[model samples]
Target: MNSDGANDMNLAALLRAGADDELQPDQKAHLDAHLRDHPRDTDRIEFERQLKEACGRVMGPISAPPALRERLIASLDRIAQDNSPRQEASSTAPAPESVRLAQGVESLSEQTRRQSFWNRMTPAVRALAAAILLLVGGLFLLQVVNVGSGNLSLAQAHMSEIATFVGDEHDRCVIDPSRAAKFNISELDAAPALLEEIVGKSISPANLAFGGLAFRDGGRCHVPGKGDSVHLRFDVVDQPGETVSLFIQRVADESDELFESGKSYELQSDNQGRAVFGWAADGLNYFLVAKDEALCESYSIERGLTPNAG
Candidate 1:
Protein backbone atom coordinates (compact mmCIF):
# COMPACT_ATOMS: atom_id res chain seq x y z
CA MET A 1 0.00 0.00 0.00
CA ASN A 2 1.05 3.60 -0.55
CA SER A 3 2.19 5.71 2.41
CA ASP A 4 -1.12 7.64 2.45
CA GLY A 5 -3.11 4.42 2.38
CA ALA A 6 -1.07 3.01 5.26
CA ASN A 7 -1.56 6.21 7.22
CA ASP A 8 -5.31 6.08 6.67
CA MET A 9 -5.45 2.46 7.79
CA ASN A 10 -3.34 3.23 10.85
CA LEU A 11 -5.52 6.21 11.70
CA ALA A 12 -8.69 4.14 11.45
CA ALA A 13 -7.19 1.43 13.64
CA LEU A 14 -6.18 4.02 16.21
CA LEU A 15 -9.73 5.36 16.25
CA ARG A 16 -11.12 1.89 16.80
CA ALA A 17 -8.55 1.19 19.49
CA GLY A 18 -9.45 4.44 21.22
CA ALA A 19 -13.08 3.45 21.41
CA ASP A 20 -12.19 -0.03 22.71
CA ASP A 21 -9.40 0.99 25.12
CA GLU A 22 -7.10 -1.52 23.45
CA LEU A 23 -4.74 0.87 21.70
CA GLN A 24 -1.24 -0.64 21.47
CA PRO A 25 2.09 1.19 21.85
CA ASP A 26 2.99 0.78 18.18
CA GLN A 27 -0.38 2.14 17.08
CA LYS A 28 0.00 5.09 19.43
CA ALA A 29 3.43 5.78 17.99
CA HIS A 30 2.13 5.60 14.42
CA LEU A 31 -0.67 7.98 15.31
CA ASP A 32 1.78 10.36 16.94
CA ALA A 33 3.90 10.36 13.82
CA HIS A 34 0.93 11.07 11.61
CA LEU A 35 -0.23 13.88 13.92
CA ARG A 36 3.25 15.42 13.74
CA ASP A 37 3.22 15.29 9.94
CA HIS A 38 -0.35 16.55 9.64
CA PRO A 39 -0.23 19.04 12.49
CA ARG A 40 -2.60 21.36 10.69
CA ASP A 41 -5.31 18.70 10.26
CA THR A 42 -7.67 19.66 13.07
CA ASP A 43 -9.73 16.55 12.40
CA ARG A 44 -6.66 14.36 12.84
CA ILE A 45 -5.60 16.20 15.98
CA GLU A 46 -9.07 16.03 17.55
CA PHE A 47 -9.40 12.35 16.68
CA GLU A 48 -6.08 11.63 18.41
CA ARG A 49 -7.03 13.77 21.37
CA GLN A 50 -10.42 12.13 21.72
CA LEU A 51 -8.90 8.68 21.57
CA LYS A 52 -6.42 9.52 24.34
CA GLU A 53 -9.17 11.17 26.39
CA ALA A 54 -11.38 8.12 26.05
CA CYS A 55 -8.56 5.98 27.39
CA GLY A 56 -8.03 8.30 30.33
CA ARG A 57 -11.76 8.57 30.98
CA VAL A 58 -12.20 4.81 31.19
CA MET A 59 -9.06 4.33 33.25
CA GLY A 60 -9.99 6.89 35.93
CA PRO A 61 -10.31 5.82 39.57
CA ILE A 62 -13.54 4.47 41.09
CA SER A 63 -14.58 3.81 44.69
CA ALA A 64 -16.92 0.91 45.58
CA PRO A 65 -18.80 0.42 48.83
CA PRO A 66 -17.32 -2.02 51.37
CA ALA A 67 -20.70 -3.62 52.06
CA LEU A 68 -21.15 -4.46 48.39
CA ARG A 69 -17.72 -6.06 48.30
CA GLU A 70 -18.49 -8.26 51.32
CA ARG A 71 -21.82 -9.28 49.87
CA LEU A 72 -20.26 -10.21 46.55
CA ILE A 73 -17.60 -12.35 48.21
CA ALA A 74 -20.22 -14.05 50.34
CA SER A 75 -22.37 -14.81 47.35
CA LEU A 76 -19.39 -16.28 45.51
CA ASP A 77 -18.67 -18.52 48.50
CA ARG A 78 -22.29 -19.68 48.55
CA ILE A 79 -22.09 -20.49 44.88
CA ALA A 80 -18.94 -22.53 45.51
CA GLN A 81 -20.71 -24.50 48.24
CA ASP A 82 -23.78 -25.04 46.12
CA ASN A 83 -21.63 -26.40 43.33
CA SER A 84 -19.67 -28.76 45.58
CA PRO A 85 -19.87 -32.48 44.69
CA ARG A 86 -22.16 -33.42 47.58
CA GLN A 87 -24.58 -30.58 46.99
CA GLU A 88 -24.57 -31.16 43.25
CA ALA A 89 -25.38 -34.82 43.71
CA SER A 90 -28.33 -34.10 45.98
CA SER A 91 -29.77 -31.34 43.80
CA THR A 92 -29.34 -33.26 40.56
CA ALA A 93 -30.49 -36.67 41.68
CA PRO A 94 -33.92 -37.80 40.48
CA ALA A 95 -36.41 -39.77 42.56
CA PRO A 96 -36.51 -43.54 41.95
CA GLU A 97 -38.95 -44.48 39.15
CA SER A 98 -40.83 -46.94 41.34
CA VAL A 99 -41.25 -44.44 44.13
CA ARG A 100 -42.37 -41.67 41.77
CA LEU A 101 -44.82 -44.03 40.10
CA ALA A 102 -46.31 -45.11 43.41
CA GLN A 103 -46.85 -41.51 44.53
CA GLY A 104 -48.47 -40.51 41.23
CA VAL A 105 -50.75 -43.56 41.16
CA GLU A 106 -51.91 -42.87 44.70
CA SER A 107 -52.69 -39.27 43.88
CA LEU A 108 -54.55 -40.16 40.66
CA SER A 109 -56.60 -42.88 42.30
CA GLU A 110 -57.59 -40.56 45.12
CA GLN A 111 -58.83 -37.98 42.61
CA THR A 112 -60.69 -40.33 40.22
CA ARG A 113 -62.85 -43.50 40.29
CA ARG A 114 -61.02 -46.67 41.40
CA GLN A 115 -62.89 -48.69 38.72
CA SER A 116 -61.71 -46.45 35.87
CA PHE A 117 -59.55 -47.94 33.08
CA TRP A 118 -56.48 -46.09 34.46
CA ASN A 119 -57.12 -47.59 37.88
CA ARG A 120 -57.64 -51.11 36.43
CA MET A 121 -54.30 -51.06 34.62
CA THR A 122 -51.64 -53.46 35.96
CA PRO A 123 -49.59 -51.98 38.78
CA ALA A 124 -46.44 -52.05 36.64
CA VAL A 125 -48.07 -50.14 33.76
CA ARG A 126 -49.58 -47.59 36.14
CA ALA A 127 -46.23 -47.06 37.79
CA LEU A 128 -44.51 -46.62 34.43
CA ALA A 129 -46.97 -43.93 33.34
CA ALA A 130 -46.68 -42.13 36.67
CA ALA A 131 -42.93 -42.23 36.45
CA ILE A 132 -42.98 -40.71 32.97
CA LEU A 133 -45.20 -37.80 34.08
CA LEU A 134 -43.10 -37.11 37.17
CA LEU A 135 -39.91 -37.13 35.12
CA VAL A 136 -41.31 -34.59 32.67
CA GLY A 137 -42.51 -32.30 35.45
CA GLY A 138 -39.23 -32.50 37.28
CA LEU A 139 -37.27 -31.73 34.16
CA PHE A 140 -39.38 -28.67 33.42
CA LEU A 141 -38.90 -27.33 36.95
CA LEU A 142 -35.18 -27.93 36.76
CA GLN A 143 -34.90 -26.03 33.49
CA VAL A 144 -36.74 -23.02 34.86
CA VAL A 145 -34.56 -22.86 37.93
CA ASN A 146 -31.43 -23.26 35.85
CA VAL A 147 -32.29 -20.34 33.59
CA GLY A 148 -33.02 -18.07 36.55
CA SER A 149 -29.82 -19.03 38.25
CA GLY A 150 -27.76 -18.43 35.13
CA ASN A 151 -28.95 -14.85 34.78
CA LEU A 152 -28.49 -14.16 38.48
CA SER A 153 -25.00 -15.59 38.40
CA LEU A 154 -24.04 -13.44 35.42
CA ALA A 155 -25.29 -10.30 37.14
CA GLN A 156 -23.52 -11.27 40.33
CA ALA A 157 -20.20 -11.81 38.58
CA HIS A 158 -20.35 -8.46 36.81
CA MET A 159 -21.18 -6.71 40.09
CA SER A 160 -18.19 -8.27 41.77
CA GLU A 161 -15.79 -7.07 39.05
CA ILE A 162 -17.16 -3.54 39.24
CA ALA A 163 -16.57 -3.47 42.99
CA THR A 164 -12.95 -4.50 42.66
CA PHE A 165 -12.13 -2.20 39.73
CA VAL A 166 -13.58 0.91 41.36
CA GLY A 167 -12.25 0.14 44.82
CA ASP A 168 -8.69 -0.71 43.87
CA GLU A 169 -7.84 1.28 40.75
CA HIS A 170 -9.19 4.62 39.35
CA ASP A 171 -7.30 7.77 40.43
CA ARG A 172 -6.55 10.47 37.81
CA CYS A 173 -8.83 11.93 35.11
CA VAL A 174 -8.04 13.07 31.55
CA ILE A 175 -9.69 15.69 29.37
CA ASP A 176 -9.86 16.42 25.64
CA PRO A 177 -9.95 20.17 24.97
CA SER A 178 -11.60 19.95 21.56
CA ARG A 179 -14.36 17.72 22.89
CA ALA A 180 -14.69 19.48 26.24
CA ALA A 181 -15.63 22.76 24.60
CA LYS A 182 -18.95 21.34 23.42
CA PHE A 183 -20.28 20.93 26.97
CA ASN A 184 -19.49 24.54 27.93
CA ILE A 185 -17.94 23.40 31.21
CA SER A 186 -14.46 23.77 32.67
CA GLU A 187 -13.88 20.83 35.07
CA LEU A 188 -15.56 18.24 37.28
CA ASP A 189 -17.76 21.01 38.64
CA ALA A 190 -19.84 20.75 35.47
CA ALA A 191 -20.39 16.99 35.78
CA PRO A 192 -23.46 16.56 38.02
CA ALA A 193 -26.07 18.52 36.09
CA LEU A 194 -24.84 17.25 32.75
CA LEU A 195 -25.00 13.65 33.97
CA GLU A 196 -28.57 14.12 35.20
CA GLU A 197 -29.58 15.63 31.89
CA ILE A 198 -27.90 12.93 29.86
CA VAL A 199 -29.45 10.18 31.97
CA GLY A 200 -32.85 11.82 31.80
CA LYS A 201 -32.59 12.27 28.05
CA SER A 202 -30.96 9.01 27.03
CA ILE A 203 -32.14 6.44 29.55
CA SER A 204 -35.62 4.97 29.18
CA PRO A 205 -37.77 4.14 32.16
CA ALA A 206 -38.06 0.50 31.06
CA ASN A 207 -34.30 -0.03 31.42
CA LEU A 208 -34.48 1.29 34.97
CA ALA A 209 -36.36 -1.85 36.04
CA PHE A 210 -33.17 -3.93 36.00
CA GLY A 211 -31.16 -1.29 37.90
CA GLY A 212 -31.88 2.08 39.46
CA LEU A 213 -29.69 5.17 39.37
CA ALA A 214 -27.70 5.69 42.56
CA PHE A 215 -25.75 8.95 42.23
CA ARG A 216 -24.79 11.60 39.65
CA ASP A 217 -21.91 14.05 39.98
CA GLY A 218 -19.37 15.96 37.88
CA GLY A 219 -15.95 17.64 38.12
CA ARG A 220 -13.03 19.09 36.15
CA CYS A 221 -9.33 18.26 35.70
CA HIS A 222 -6.35 18.37 33.31
CA VAL A 223 -4.70 15.60 31.37
CA PRO A 224 -1.13 15.68 30.11
CA GLY A 225 -0.94 17.67 26.83
CA LYS A 226 -4.73 18.13 26.97
CA GLY A 227 -6.76 21.02 28.37
CA ASP A 228 -9.64 21.14 30.87
CA SER A 229 -12.58 18.74 30.32
CA VAL A 230 -15.90 18.03 32.01
CA HIS A 231 -16.33 14.80 33.98
CA LEU A 232 -19.86 13.61 34.65
CA ARG A 233 -20.57 10.61 36.87
CA PHE A 234 -23.58 8.39 37.54
CA ASP A 235 -23.97 5.56 40.04
CA VAL A 236 -26.55 2.78 40.32
CA VAL A 237 -28.05 1.58 43.60
CA ASP A 238 -28.08 -2.15 42.90
CA GLN A 239 -24.46 -2.03 41.76
CA PRO A 240 -23.51 0.10 44.78
CA GLY A 241 -20.68 2.62 44.28
CA GLU A 242 -20.10 1.55 40.68
CA THR A 243 -19.93 4.69 38.52
CA VAL A 244 -20.26 5.68 34.84
CA SER A 245 -18.27 8.71 33.64
CA LEU A 246 -18.97 10.97 30.66
CA PHE A 247 -16.33 13.34 29.19
CA ILE A 248 -17.46 16.18 26.95
CA GLN A 249 -15.66 18.93 24.99
CA ARG A 250 -16.11 21.29 22.04
CA VAL A 251 -13.67 22.19 19.30
CA ALA A 252 -13.80 24.88 16.62
CA ASP A 253 -12.61 22.48 13.96
CA GLU A 254 -14.22 19.19 13.00
CA SER A 255 -11.75 16.58 14.27
CA ASP A 256 -13.48 13.96 16.41
CA GLU A 257 -16.41 12.20 14.77
CA LEU A 258 -19.78 11.53 16.35
CA PHE A 259 -21.42 8.10 16.76
CA GLU A 260 -21.68 6.24 13.49
CA SER A 261 -21.78 2.74 12.10
CA GLY A 262 -18.65 0.67 12.84
CA LYS A 263 -17.52 3.29 15.32
CA SER A 264 -17.42 2.41 19.04
CA TYR A 265 -16.77 4.00 22.48
CA GLU A 266 -15.49 2.34 25.65
CA LEU A 267 -14.41 2.85 29.24
CA GLN A 268 -11.51 0.82 30.58
CA SER A 269 -9.79 0.54 33.96
CA ASP A 270 -6.25 1.76 34.35
CA ASN A 271 -3.59 0.82 36.90
CA GLN A 272 -4.94 3.62 39.11
CA GLY A 273 -8.65 2.69 39.01
CA ARG A 274 -11.45 0.37 37.91
CA ALA A 275 -12.85 -0.11 34.38
CA VAL A 276 -14.86 2.66 32.69
CA PHE A 277 -17.11 2.86 29.58
CA GLY A 278 -16.95 5.68 26.95
CA TRP A 279 -18.42 6.72 23.57
CA ALA A 280 -19.39 9.84 21.61
CA ALA A 281 -22.77 11.26 20.63
CA ASP A 282 -24.14 14.66 19.65
CA GLY A 283 -20.68 16.24 19.58
CA LEU A 284 -19.82 14.72 22.98
CA ASN A 285 -17.60 11.80 23.91
CA TYR A 286 -18.77 9.73 26.88
CA PHE A 287 -17.06 7.16 29.08
CA LEU A 288 -19.07 4.91 31.42
CA VAL A 289 -17.00 2.49 33.36
CA ALA A 290 -17.55 0.23 36.35
CA LYS A 291 -16.19 -3.10 37.53
CA ASP A 292 -19.65 -4.50 36.73
CA GLU A 293 -19.76 -4.87 32.94
CA ALA A 294 -23.36 -6.11 33.06
CA LEU A 295 -24.50 -3.04 34.91
CA CYS A 296 -22.47 -0.92 32.49
CA GLU A 297 -24.22 -2.68 29.60
CA SER A 298 -27.65 -2.04 31.06
CA TYR A 299 -26.77 1.61 31.56
CA SER A 300 -25.57 1.83 27.97
CA ILE A 301 -28.84 0.52 26.59
CA GLU A 302 -30.88 2.63 28.97
CA ARG A 303 -29.09 5.71 27.72
CA GLY A 304 -29.58 4.66 24.09
CA LEU A 305 -25.83 4.07 23.85
CA THR A 306 -23.97 1.12 22.39
CA PRO A 307 -20.91 -0.44 24.03
CA ASN A 308 -17.51 -0.67 22.33
CA ALA A 309 -17.20 -4.33 23.27
CA GLY A 310 -14.56 -4.86 20.60
Candidate 2:
Protein backbone atom coordinates (compact mmCIF):
# COMPACT_ATOMS: atom_id res chain seq x y z
CA MET A 1 0.00 0.00 0.00
CA ASN A 2 1.07 3.64 -0.65
CA SER A 3 2.18 5.81 2.31
CA ASP A 4 -1.18 7.64 2.32
CA GLY A 5 -3.16 4.35 2.31
CA ALA A 6 -0.90 2.91 5.00
CA ASN A 7 -1.40 5.99 7.20
CA ASP A 8 -5.20 5.76 6.72
CA MET A 9 -5.18 2.07 7.74
CA ASN A 10 -3.05 2.89 10.78
CA LEU A 11 -5.41 5.66 11.81
CA ALA A 12 -8.41 3.31 11.46
CA ALA A 13 -6.67 0.72 13.63
CA LEU A 14 -5.89 3.34 16.26
CA LEU A 15 -9.48 4.51 16.28
CA ARG A 16 -10.69 0.96 16.88
CA ALA A 17 -8.21 0.51 19.78
CA GLY A 18 -9.24 3.89 21.22
CA ALA A 19 -12.90 2.82 21.21
CA ASP A 20 -12.21 -0.11 23.55
CA ASP A 21 -9.74 -0.40 26.43
CA GLU A 22 -9.77 -4.22 26.14
CA LEU A 23 -7.51 -4.07 23.10
CA GLN A 24 -4.94 -6.88 22.88
CA PRO A 25 -1.19 -6.26 23.29
CA ASP A 26 -0.60 -6.57 19.55
CA GLN A 27 -3.43 -4.14 18.88
CA LYS A 28 -1.87 -1.72 21.34
CA ALA A 29 1.55 -2.10 19.64
CA HIS A 30 -0.08 -1.37 16.27
CA LEU A 31 -1.76 1.72 17.67
CA ASP A 32 1.55 2.88 19.15
CA ALA A 33 3.13 2.50 15.72
CA HIS A 34 0.35 4.63 14.23
CA LEU A 35 0.88 7.32 16.87
CA ARG A 36 4.59 7.37 16.05
CA ASP A 37 3.73 7.89 12.36
CA HIS A 38 1.20 10.63 13.12
CA PRO A 39 2.73 12.25 16.24
CA ARG A 40 0.78 15.50 15.78
CA ASP A 41 -2.70 13.91 15.77
CA THR A 42 -3.92 15.56 18.99
CA ASP A 43 -7.58 15.07 18.19
CA ARG A 44 -7.13 11.32 17.68
CA ILE A 45 -5.13 11.02 20.92
CA GLU A 46 -7.81 12.84 22.95
CA PHE A 47 -10.50 10.72 21.29
CA GLU A 48 -8.66 7.55 22.33
CA ARG A 49 -8.32 8.74 25.94
CA GLN A 50 -12.01 9.68 26.19
CA LEU A 51 -13.01 6.32 24.73
CA LYS A 52 -10.84 4.55 27.30
CA GLU A 53 -12.34 6.51 30.18
CA ALA A 54 -15.88 5.79 28.99
CA CYS A 55 -15.12 2.05 28.69
CA GLY A 56 -13.44 1.97 32.11
CA ARG A 57 -16.45 3.59 33.75
CA VAL A 58 -18.62 0.70 32.63
CA MET A 59 -16.07 -2.14 33.10
CA GLY A 60 -17.28 -3.43 36.41
CA PRO A 61 -19.18 -6.52 37.66
CA ILE A 62 -22.39 -7.58 35.92
CA SER A 63 -24.87 -10.40 36.45
CA ALA A 64 -27.58 -11.48 33.96
CA PRO A 65 -31.21 -11.67 35.16
CA PRO A 66 -32.42 -15.28 35.01
CA ALA A 67 -35.94 -14.58 33.77
CA LEU A 68 -34.70 -12.22 31.08
CA ARG A 69 -32.15 -14.78 29.91
CA GLU A 70 -34.76 -17.52 29.73
CA ARG A 71 -37.21 -15.32 27.82
CA LEU A 72 -34.54 -14.22 25.33
CA ILE A 73 -33.50 -17.80 24.58
CA ALA A 74 -37.13 -18.79 24.03
CA SER A 75 -37.72 -15.89 21.63
CA LEU A 76 -34.59 -16.73 19.62
CA ASP A 77 -35.75 -20.34 19.27
CA ARG A 78 -39.15 -19.20 18.00
CA ILE A 79 -37.54 -16.86 15.47
CA ALA A 80 -35.27 -19.66 14.21
CA GLN A 81 -38.28 -21.95 13.71
CA ASP A 82 -40.21 -19.22 11.87
CA ASN A 83 -37.28 -18.77 9.47
CA SER A 84 -36.83 -22.50 8.77
CA PRO A 85 -37.18 -23.98 5.25
CA ARG A 86 -40.62 -25.50 5.95
CA GLN A 87 -41.99 -22.16 7.15
CA GLU A 88 -40.44 -20.31 4.20
CA ALA A 89 -41.80 -22.85 1.74
CA SER A 90 -45.31 -22.54 3.14
CA SER A 91 -45.09 -18.74 2.96
CA THR A 92 -43.84 -18.71 -0.65
CA ALA A 93 -46.11 -21.41 -2.08
CA PRO A 94 -48.75 -20.06 -4.50
CA ALA A 95 -52.14 -21.66 -3.80
CA PRO A 96 -55.18 -22.10 -6.07
CA GLU A 97 -58.51 -20.58 -4.93
CA SER A 98 -59.69 -23.92 -3.52
CA VAL A 99 -56.34 -24.52 -1.78
CA ARG A 100 -56.50 -20.99 -0.27
CA LEU A 101 -59.99 -21.74 1.07
CA ALA A 102 -58.78 -25.04 2.52
CA GLN A 103 -55.76 -23.30 4.12
CA GLY A 104 -58.08 -20.72 5.73
CA VAL A 105 -60.13 -23.55 7.20
CA GLU A 106 -56.98 -25.30 8.45
CA SER A 107 -55.74 -22.08 10.05
CA LEU A 108 -59.07 -21.65 11.82
CA SER A 109 -58.92 -25.27 12.96
CA GLU A 110 -55.41 -24.79 14.30
CA GLN A 111 -56.56 -21.70 16.21
CA THR A 112 -59.48 -23.71 17.63
CA ARG A 113 -57.07 -26.47 18.68
CA ARG A 114 -54.87 -23.94 20.50
CA GLN A 115 -57.91 -22.44 22.20
CA SER A 116 -59.16 -25.91 23.22
CA PHE A 117 -55.70 -26.77 24.64
CA TRP A 118 -55.78 -23.64 26.78
CA ASN A 119 -59.37 -24.31 27.80
CA ARG A 120 -58.45 -27.87 28.83
CA MET A 121 -55.88 -26.56 31.33
CA THR A 122 -57.02 -27.10 34.89
CA PRO A 123 -57.72 -24.04 37.01
CA ALA A 124 -55.11 -25.17 39.47
CA VAL A 125 -52.48 -25.40 36.71
CA ARG A 126 -53.30 -21.92 35.40
CA ALA A 127 -53.28 -20.47 38.88
CA LEU A 128 -49.99 -22.15 39.69
CA ALA A 129 -48.33 -20.75 36.52
CA ALA A 130 -49.59 -17.25 37.27
CA ALA A 131 -48.41 -17.53 40.86
CA ILE A 132 -44.95 -18.63 39.75
CA LEU A 133 -44.64 -15.69 37.34
CA LEU A 134 -45.76 -13.23 39.99
CA LEU A 135 -43.35 -14.70 42.52
CA VAL A 136 -40.39 -14.47 40.14
CA GLY A 137 -41.26 -10.90 39.23
CA GLY A 138 -41.70 -9.92 42.88
CA LEU A 139 -38.36 -11.46 43.82
CA PHE A 140 -36.60 -9.53 41.03
CA LEU A 141 -38.19 -6.26 42.17
CA LEU A 142 -37.27 -6.97 45.78
CA GLN A 143 -33.65 -7.57 44.83
CA VAL A 144 -33.46 -4.23 43.02
CA VAL A 145 -34.97 -2.38 45.98
CA ASN A 146 -32.63 -4.11 48.40
CA VAL A 147 -29.60 -3.23 46.29
CA GLY A 148 -30.21 0.42 47.16
CA SER A 149 -31.98 0.23 50.52
CA GLY A 150 -29.90 -2.50 52.12
CA ASN A 151 -26.58 -0.82 51.39
CA LEU A 152 -27.79 2.54 52.67
CA SER A 153 -29.06 0.95 55.87
CA LEU A 154 -25.81 -0.89 56.46
CA ALA A 155 -23.74 2.24 55.87
CA GLN A 156 -25.88 4.32 58.21
CA ALA A 157 -25.56 1.68 60.91
CA HIS A 158 -21.78 1.62 60.54
CA MET A 159 -21.51 5.41 60.80
CA SER A 160 -23.69 5.50 63.90
CA GLU A 161 -21.54 2.84 65.52
CA ILE A 162 -18.34 4.77 64.79
CA ALA A 163 -19.78 8.03 66.08
CA THR A 164 -20.94 6.41 69.32
CA PHE A 165 -17.58 4.76 69.82
CA VAL A 166 -15.76 8.09 69.48
CA GLY A 167 -18.10 9.78 71.93
CA ASP A 168 -17.65 6.99 74.48
CA GLU A 169 -13.90 7.32 74.20
CA HIS A 170 -14.10 11.05 74.92
CA ASP A 171 -16.40 10.60 77.94
CA ARG A 172 -14.30 7.81 79.36
CA CYS A 173 -11.30 10.11 79.20
CA VAL A 174 -13.17 12.90 81.03
CA ILE A 175 -14.35 10.72 83.95
CA ASP A 176 -11.29 8.46 84.43
CA PRO A 177 -9.47 10.79 86.86
CA SER A 178 -12.50 11.01 89.15
CA ARG A 179 -12.96 7.26 89.01
CA ALA A 180 -9.30 6.65 89.78
CA ALA A 181 -9.25 9.15 92.69
CA LYS A 182 -12.53 7.83 94.11
CA PHE A 183 -11.47 4.20 93.89
CA ASN A 184 -7.91 4.96 95.15
CA ILE A 185 -6.74 3.41 91.88
CA SER A 186 -3.17 4.60 91.38
CA GLU A 187 -3.28 7.21 88.60
CA LEU A 188 0.34 6.44 87.91
CA ASP A 189 2.38 3.23 87.65
CA ALA A 190 0.29 0.56 85.93
CA ALA A 191 1.56 -2.49 84.00
CA PRO A 192 2.54 -1.82 80.36
CA ALA A 193 1.64 -5.44 79.64
CA LEU A 194 -2.01 -4.56 80.33
CA LEU A 195 -2.12 -2.07 77.47
CA GLU A 196 -0.67 -4.64 75.07
CA GLU A 197 -3.15 -7.28 76.19
CA ILE A 198 -6.36 -5.32 75.46
CA VAL A 199 -5.24 -3.41 72.35
CA GLY A 200 -3.95 -6.61 70.76
CA LYS A 201 -0.21 -7.03 70.23
CA SER A 202 -0.97 -7.03 66.50
CA ILE A 203 -2.18 -3.43 66.63
CA SER A 204 0.72 -1.20 65.72
CA PRO A 205 1.48 1.80 67.92
CA ALA A 206 1.13 3.90 64.76
CA ASN A 207 -2.57 3.02 64.69
CA LEU A 208 -3.26 4.73 68.06
CA ALA A 209 -4.46 8.16 66.92
CA PHE A 210 -7.02 8.97 69.59
CA GLY A 211 -7.21 12.75 70.23
CA GLY A 212 -8.40 12.21 73.83
CA LEU A 213 -5.21 10.36 74.80
CA ALA A 214 -3.11 13.50 75.38
CA PHE A 215 -4.81 14.77 78.58
CA ARG A 216 -3.90 12.68 81.65
CA ASP A 217 -0.17 13.44 81.24
CA GLY A 218 0.15 10.68 78.58
CA GLY A 219 -0.02 7.91 81.18
CA ARG A 220 -1.11 4.36 80.18
CA CYS A 221 -1.82 1.27 82.27
CA HIS A 222 -3.53 -2.04 81.73
CA VAL A 223 -6.28 -3.63 83.82
CA PRO A 224 -5.87 -7.38 83.89
CA GLY A 225 -8.07 -10.48 83.95
CA LYS A 226 -11.64 -9.78 82.85
CA GLY A 227 -11.98 -12.89 80.67
CA ASP A 228 -9.52 -12.22 77.86
CA SER A 229 -10.20 -8.49 78.08
CA VAL A 230 -7.62 -5.65 78.27
CA HIS A 231 -8.20 -2.11 79.49
CA LEU A 232 -6.19 1.06 78.76
CA ARG A 233 -6.27 4.63 80.15
CA PHE A 234 -4.40 7.65 78.88
CA ASP A 235 -4.50 11.45 79.31
CA VAL A 236 -5.11 14.00 76.56
CA VAL A 237 -2.64 16.83 77.28
CA ASP A 238 -3.93 18.95 74.43
CA GLN A 239 -7.44 18.84 75.90
CA PRO A 240 -5.84 19.77 79.31
CA GLY A 241 -7.38 18.07 82.35
CA GLU A 242 -9.16 15.19 80.67
CA THR A 243 -8.43 11.44 80.63
CA VAL A 244 -9.67 8.65 78.35
CA SER A 245 -9.90 4.92 78.89
CA LEU A 246 -10.14 2.21 76.23
CA PHE A 247 -11.02 -1.43 76.68
CA ILE A 248 -10.36 -4.21 74.21
CA GLN A 249 -12.04 -7.58 74.61
CA ARG A 250 -11.28 -10.67 72.60
CA VAL A 251 -14.49 -12.66 72.15
CA ALA A 252 -13.25 -15.24 69.66
CA ASP A 253 -16.27 -17.47 70.05
CA GLU A 254 -18.73 -14.61 69.54
CA SER A 255 -16.67 -13.29 66.65
CA ASP A 256 -16.74 -16.64 64.92
CA GLU A 257 -20.52 -16.89 65.28
CA LEU A 258 -21.14 -13.39 63.96
CA PHE A 259 -18.52 -13.54 61.21
CA GLU A 260 -21.14 -13.73 58.46
CA SER A 261 -23.91 -11.84 60.19
CA GLY A 262 -24.72 -8.21 61.03
CA LYS A 263 -25.83 -7.00 64.46
CA SER A 264 -26.55 -3.72 66.21
CA TYR A 265 -26.95 -2.92 69.91
CA GLU A 266 -27.18 -0.21 72.53
CA LEU A 267 -24.75 -0.28 75.43
CA GLN A 268 -25.19 1.58 78.70
CA SER A 269 -22.37 2.11 81.16
CA ASP A 270 -22.78 1.03 84.80
CA ASN A 271 -23.04 4.69 85.79
CA GLN A 272 -25.96 5.12 83.37
CA GLY A 273 -24.14 8.23 82.14
CA ARG A 274 -22.45 6.69 79.08
CA ALA A 275 -24.07 5.19 76.01
CA VAL A 276 -22.50 3.03 73.32
CA PHE A 277 -23.31 2.33 69.69
CA GLY A 278 -22.53 -1.28 68.97
CA TRP A 279 -22.39 -3.18 65.68
CA ALA A 280 -21.15 -6.74 65.36
CA ALA A 281 -20.31 -8.58 62.18
CA ASP A 282 -17.69 -10.99 60.87
CA GLY A 283 -16.50 -11.73 64.38
CA LEU A 284 -15.94 -8.12 65.52
CA ASN A 285 -18.08 -5.93 67.72
CA TYR A 286 -17.49 -2.18 67.74
CA PHE A 287 -19.06 0.33 70.15
CA LEU A 288 -18.75 4.06 69.68
CA VAL A 289 -20.39 7.27 70.97
CA ALA A 290 -20.62 9.56 74.00
CA LYS A 291 -21.53 8.87 77.63
CA ASP A 292 -25.22 9.60 77.30
CA GLU A 293 -28.11 7.13 77.57
CA ALA A 294 -30.16 9.13 75.11
CA LEU A 295 -27.38 9.06 72.49
CA CYS A 296 -27.07 5.29 72.85
CA GLU A 297 -30.81 4.84 72.48
CA SER A 298 -30.89 6.99 69.38
CA TYR A 299 -27.92 5.17 67.87
CA SER A 300 -29.47 1.80 68.53
CA ILE A 301 -32.79 2.82 66.99
CA GLU A 302 -31.17 4.30 63.88
CA ARG A 303 -29.12 1.14 63.37
CA GLY A 304 -32.09 -1.22 63.68
CA LEU A 305 -30.42 -2.67 66.78
CA THR A 306 -33.53 -2.10 68.87
CA PRO A 307 -36.44 -4.47 68.36
CA ASN A 308 -39.67 -2.87 67.01
CA ALA A 309 -37.68 0.14 65.77
CA GLY A 310 -36.71 -0.94 62.26
Superposition error at 106 for model 2 (Å): 72
Q: Put down candidate 1 lDDT per residue, 128-210, tens digits, no spaces.
A: 54554364442211000111211333322332333233232232222223433333433333444443454322322232222
lDDT of 1: 0.40
Where does the lowest 10-residue lDDT sum fall in candidate 1?
141-150
Q: Tell me, what's the RMSD of every candidate?
A: 22.6, 27.7
Q: Which stretches of candidate 2 lie over 4 Å from their true place?
A: 1-200, 215-227, 236-239, 255-272, 279-289, 292-310
Show how many residue pairs clash in every candidate, following the order shown: 42, 21
Per-residue C-alpha lDDT of model 2 across residues 123-200, encoded as one tens digit per residue: 764464345435444221100011121133333323333333444434544545443432222333332333344433
Tell how far residue 279 is off in model 1, in angstroms: 2.0
Decoy 2 TM-score against native: 0.26
